[model samples]
Target chain A: MSIKGTDYYTIDELMAVCMARTIKNGDTIFNGVAVPLPFTAIMLAFKTHAPESIFWSGLLAGLNPDPPFLPPTSGDSVMLHRANPILHLHQIFDLAMRGELDRIFFSGAQIDKYGNLNNTLIGTLDNIKIKLPGGAGSSHIGCFAKNYTIWSIRHDAKVSSKGQRVFTFVESVDFVTTVGRRTSTRNRDELGLMGGGPDCVVTNLCTFDFDPLTDVMRLKTLHPGVTVEEVLENTGFEPVLSDTIVETPPPTKEEIALIREIDPMNTRKVGFSRSALEKRYDF
Target chain B: MGIHSSKDKVCSLSKAVSRIEDGSIIAVGGNLSAREPMAIIREMIRQGKCNMHSIGGAHGVDIDLLCAGGVLRRVQNSYVGFEADFGLAPNYRRMVQQKKVIPKDTDCVAVLMQLRASVYGLPFMPMKLVTGTNILDLHPEYIVMTCPYTGEKLSLLPAVKPDWAIIHAHKSDPKGNIKLHPPYFADLLAIEASQNSIVSVEEIVSEEEMDKIGATVPYYEVTAVVELPFGAHPTSCYPDYTYDRKHLAEYVKLANRGEDVFRKEYLEKYVFGVKSHDEYLELVGGHDALEELTKWNQGTEKWCELLGRNL
Candidate 1:
């Protein structure tokens, strides 16, 4: 049962898409929090060291990525699992300011033509009215977590640029979370970004990976039945289309069970859409 | 440096806490009993570490010792409940009520901020959440004002970098290399946010042993590594294969009875009597004593479960 590409994807599928892109089995990659994606990336690794594992680092220095390994936000015993912590998150920042983080995924309040994020506030800094989730941690962390950037947009929200969303009566953040190549000003040496702004925008439609230059989110992969045109139509900004757009793999039974049964918090509240799946995806 | 695979480190009950310095920010790692370094934390209590800063996602025994010892200066935690309803964590709740330990009204942002700082190696992080929120203004300790280039007001919240992160884990190698299976305590951020770390382990193998298994946390970052068996006493996870039931019940008894009462009967026995986890076990006196203690702990846990609340 799917609407748009929703019927073809699951929350765990989104989780997996994000995790698979960022974490390697034993890489000591650092992670940030507020959601399970990064934590899942760590836990999913076969070579993770828990009860001592640090998050939000750039490299994967002997990190444990085991199945049963707990997510970082839990407690001490969960995080202490580690291997050779090549460097702490603080040290990793040296890489970040210098542009070293391999993959970054921070939620954005708005996204635009180019993938610049607006996680800080819903409205302008002055005469402020609506405030979405604060960007205290996400703001700086986003600067570092570069490779696999993402913004989890609800299927129902109507906003401006992913970078400039307007969620309230007043002008809130525009719709863009990760700007398309057409939007972002490119500058890595001076801490500027293009496609790195929002490499992937995860929504009900499907996953879109941004081009390094254009910042426009190219259609990386569609869910089992999602169409490129449908995704493009629903998208606020015109997304960059990858040379060979692919289809998202279907969810395995185990993935479904984990999404529904084990995680009660429903952190990723995505379910397959009935209509999206029932209809054709070749738009 | 390493653990003897066969021998459990000094099997016993711990009462007194030692080795904890005053005014240190200590991160307690465990949830209920699954993955906390309970024994070492108890040891810190026996050592009489005062004016302490304690942090945890969900703490059980460690909170008890810190509170009972009257050593808490500040507490940053999500929630604190003994095996049963320990009457709103007297040391914290009472202190908040009586203005002893000031509860810095904050939310989940600080937790993420600390991890972010540690992750990035920044001294303090400039965040966007606490700004314009009560948390920034409410806790004088966390607030700072900044003037943006555009002639606007911005508040800067100093980051939380703990002095030491004390945690107990399932396995580790000689060089303090650790292995966490799953459902671990919140070690990622706790370790990330702290300046230093100490690990008390259930079992320690050789470095080769750790290597054989695979990657583990390097020992260089860990200042102290001890092989303390039953390390997480009063905690329900490893060693003895069961939770300390009666001990938990005792905590609840003291909790329900009130802080003063908790001090007299329960804290006196557990918090004051023994210094080491071993001593606490010895004072447990025998198999029957141990069994009885666990029974009560389990009962208290059930009672708390039945009541179904932290407050």
Candidate 2:
């Protein structure tokens, strides 16, 4: 359980630390609903290096809330505790539309190599297989926020009843709920998207950044025990590998303490599976 | 639009909901699990309103109950499932998978833009985003046109003038003037944009008290108001009460059991089984349950406990 260091941490903690590292010191960050990982990461960033960063609690519509504890649902009014200058839903979207938002985080059911997200449904409109919660503001935020990051708790592929490998990272998403780096044939610039598509995708297993030239997902870092081979096996399409893939930096003791303090109920573990939750790492 | 200057617009929940007809496009206020018009939604189900089109921002049990009750023909909201608290809304997912309710999935900005267009008395509003996403494909009604001022292509979202805007608030007057707490979500916009609006509040204060509170929704926009305390039960009405997590947990459990069981166990037991909101309240542990939800104001520890979070 030890990875090159003495401090023990879980995958969720590492994910939160990695995500927090992406945030800038004064970025006006926002996160969508049901995202405890990002919510924790944002709070971690605020408490640590990004103290000046403006944290807008999505759905709750609170600004820089000093919540006592992380609620299970992001929409919980507890997020408004000590929050200043509460903004309405329209005002939040208006800020994004006016291109004032600095950074936002989103999670999806399906993500393609090009970073297109699908939270709408699994199948076509006519014949649906599974109906997921529709994308709340992903489509607009992905297009308007200055920058956005995609995070997910699920990274591994599943074996369907028919024995097909069902990949969370697919070659093409069934529906594009959020436009990422590019579509199948056109780039975001050509399509007149306002914001930078997707900066990076942080998952349970590894971290990915878009290839600068092609906009395809590129493997940037792997978690403590994950390997390139495992990522390739789980992904439906091949990802551009960096010249040097490094291990994701383990969560510092301070970061771990802050995360625990923010989420004492361990609400962040709700997104992980039972086995994944049991995984531990010695930093 | 005609002005609603009536001195007294107060009515019973049943009488207010009777104005909503089948196949009407409805805009529901409140975001996610907070401040939703739950009592009004229950009344609508009791009245057997069907084939309605629902539009909103983020939502959970409010729309799910409608779908479970077989009340919607089209769902145009941005998001619906119970966020992290539970998971995918069982009844809504089943209904969409079965093609019983057509999913007209929309984005939050697009919805706001369309509603703004309606409020501005315009035919459509143009936007630069949502062009490359499948939302444009899902909504064929959006028109992609080349902007005359600049050569950039823009998507024009048509105005969404709903037949009714249903909302729940903390306080209102008999004349229908209302006051809402912070984080208003799209309630005010929805009220002004819709052709008509009906509100349910925790208390009906005097017109003088409404003036002192400063009305968020003016009397001219609201068609009717009902004093239905705990109207947003199962959903939080901050400063009044938090979401009924234990009750919502039971609802999610029953909803996951399948549509037939939900209809019988949940719909028949809590919704249809009760003749009025008072009866429904009595069934749900009466005053004790409601008092516990309001205990968030007691302290941070009690608030965390209300949210099922232990310090």
Chain B only, TM-score of each candidate: 0.74, 0.97
lDDT values of the candidates?
Answer: 0.49, 0.87
TM-scores vs. true structure, each candidate: 0.46, 0.97
Instruction: Summarize candidate 1's per-residue lDDT along B1-311 as a digit string, tens digits.
Output: 11123322322222212344578887777654345676676666566668887765445556655766666777665344431123234454454455555443233335546556665677666543222222333357664445465443333556677778777766676555676544443565676567666777767777678788774555555555677766766664422334554555666666656777877776677657765566777775555644442342243343233122232
Per-residue lDDT for A1-283 in model 1, tens only?
Answer: 1123333344444545444444443333444334454445444332222334334421222234332223212222223334343333335544444445555455444655344554323333332333232332333444344455555544333555565633311112332222223333334423333113344566555776667664455777776656886665555666678888887655544444343332333323323345533443222
Candidate 2 per-residue lDDT over residues B179-240, each given as its tens digit: 98977888888998998899999999998898888988788898999999999998989888
In model 1 chain A, which range of ten residues has the least summed lDDT?
A168-177
TM-score winner: 2
DockQ of 2: 0.73
Lowest lDDT 10-residue stretch of candidate 2 chain A: A1-10
Q: What DockQ does candidate 1 score? A: 0.03
lDDT (0-100) at residue A81 of candidate 2?
Answer: 83
Off by over 4 Å in 2: A1-7, B309-311
Indicate the TM-score of model 2. Answer: 0.97
RMSD of each: 12.6, 2.5
